[model samples]
Target: MIRCDAHMHTRFSEDSDASVHSMLDAAIERGMEAVCITDHLDKDFPQTPDFPAGAFLFDLGNYFQRLTQLKEEYQKKLEVRIGVEIGLQPHLGEYYKELTEKYPFDFVIGSVHLIHGQDPYYRGFFEGRSDEEAYHEAFEVTIENLKKINSFDSLGHLDYVVRYGTHQAEEYSYRKYADEIDEILKHLISHGKGLEMNMAGMKYGLGFPNPHPDVIRRYRELGGEIVTIGADAHRPEHVAFDFDKAGEILISCGFSYYAEFKGRKPIFKRIVP
Candidate 1:
């Protein structure tokens, strides 16, 4: 079983109302060995008139203060790691670089949640574009960000666009974007960065991980080794969702080990049959 949940959000994340203490209690109840509080930190966020500005940005001082208190409080029962999930954009690459450098984070998950100043979460982004066009454009932007930045530890939810695509993920497959996907994987491998096996797809009813099983297999075949398991949980109950199934998926993809990070270094743990 994957013992550590490396991606989670708390009250610090604008999208979530869960507190750090409540989440820690839930992780303990589920028998988790470790949990990382990776709250959202999306800089230069394109705020809509309705969305307002700096909504996703969290106070670093308050975040660390709460983290330090919780780490000390739960140090005996569960291990807590300080982490951040950075929303990558072409123009904010340098901003994230300085952010990561300024903080002492255990892990960083780089994710692309927007394209052309719009998010796929809303239907309007996919209104005129074909699902194929939308998905491909998202991947293209991912490649652009990956090339421009090298500060994050792993790429979060590689095929994130498919989760919210108008037609859903039924029409998506790795074969359709093999070249672009390969380029992304090659960039990660070259930089010694990792990939995250995000289980949020199950919650979204996609019946697979963010990148799909074939994409994970291809990542392994391309000599990519570092992989972390996370439910991408924003609430207490969502932590470590379908982790056993995630292990099965990893083993089927020829990954005998999943990764855990401390001080920004990956330590692989063997997957048992």
Candidate 2:
């Protein structure tokens, strides 16, 4: 019944301040069966003048230690899966492959948070580009990354750019980038990878899940079955946010099951009414 929130950030992620214990408490309080700690691991993240190089990157040694402790501490109350959200850039495919191969993570979410070394979250990314151009570029880059990388279990937040788009995803839809989106889905299906139903869009004021229901429907139509639901929460309160609505969206998209991962393999759970 979609009991697992598979994508969440903790203090290990530079942008997140939520502690591992706090996130676990929140998930348990919400009656969650499991919550995976998918901290960010953006290799070769572009450096900003204000910060030191690789600020978004975490110390893998410390992260694994914390994860081991958390799993032991929360074993009885909730399931804690070790996961990572690797920022997928065009040039870092081999690096990520080596990193994931070295780590024993339960799942890996390959995300395109950066486009052409610029994060779409800031206004400057859309300063001169048309909404169409921005969105299309994001999709095109994602398709390229997917074609090149075979390391992640699911693609995180397919329409992540929309949250920060100048138009606020007001007119974004599957029709606008259907060809590109379809190609991305086809690659995922062919590689046994999945898509993530990221609920962060609602919190980010997009009023919909990332990739929207139309996109999810198209993925299902293209024989894509594995879809993981995540709050994309960076804080305790945001964990599992808008999940009920997410489930409704999946049901509407004709998805009878949602996926959860273990040892990088998908475990589908039926959606119960």
Candidate 3:
């Protein structure tokens, strides 16, 4: 299969379990054509920048060093790409901008993992906030963050609230939030930002694909041409999970092809199963 999983995470990310070698090995074993290692970098993880969440121990120097060595080591076996997942908070834009300026990433994902300073990975975040409030904040924060940092390529998991919210996918379809969704798609389209097809929704049993296929179609309807499918895999087992389904969603979303990056520029290819 000719496939690329652009959003896999490694142990460098706070919640991930796979290592760079482990993820790449899984991709090679699965016969994937390419893969990107996009570990998380949120400055608020304590003492870094505007984030007080404590410093994350993600070592970029080592990451690049090892990636360079591994790319050379595995070039004939598999193509490994360098990427980073930056958590977007309005307060941390400048830091991220400066950081990316110094690092040449093949892919950069802008995701909203926290709302109002709390991560939804924890349970209580879905408790105190109403479903509407939670969903609204998620969308608003994503839009606000994207607006602030227009430099990134793809907008990650636009419907991520469903993964951790009080509501399920059946209750959280495109019709319920069309206006805001349109605004987001239009903004991204205007800025030429691609959307990410994160298959983690299916992996987590969220019923629909991440961002919901309907929303993806709407994005295409609003002139969105570029997209990147990511399993958002934190473990080897999750790598390229549901990739066929992601491609199907893209085709139905009016996209004839999907994109992968090298040297921070897009190279589009038709979705092949």
Candidate 2, residue 38: CA error in Å?
A: 0.4
lDDT of the candidates, in the order given: 0.89, 0.89, 0.82
> What is candidate 1's lDDT per residue for 1-273, written digit by digit as tens?
888999999989888989888898888887789998899998867676446766689888888888989899999999999999999888887888888888899999999988977888888899999999998999999999998878899999999999998878766889999989999999999999999999999899999987798988998999999998889989899988888788899999989999988899998998875
* Ranked candidates, highest lDDT first: 1, 2, 3
lDDT, candidate 3, 16-44, per-residue tens: 76777888998987768899888888767
**Model 2 agreement with the true structure over 1-273: per-residue lDDT tens digits:** 568999999998888989889999999887799988899988877666544567788888889888999899889999999999999988887899899999899999999988998888777789889888999999999998987888999999998999888777765889978999999999999999999999998888778899788999999999999999999899999999987777779999999899999999989899875
Candidate no. 1 TM-score: 0.97
Task: Give me the displacement of residue 85 in model 3, in angstroms.
Answer: 0.3
* Candidate 3 lDDT (Cα, 0 to 1): 0.82
Cα deviation at 116, candidate 1, in Å, is: 1.4
Best by TM-score: 1
Residue 180 accuracy (lDDT) in model 1: 93
Candidate 2 has an lDDT of: 0.89
Lowest lDDT block of 10, candidate 1: 46-55
What's the C-alpha lDDT at position 131 in model 3? 73
Which RMSD values do the candidates have, in order? 1.1, 1.2, 2.7
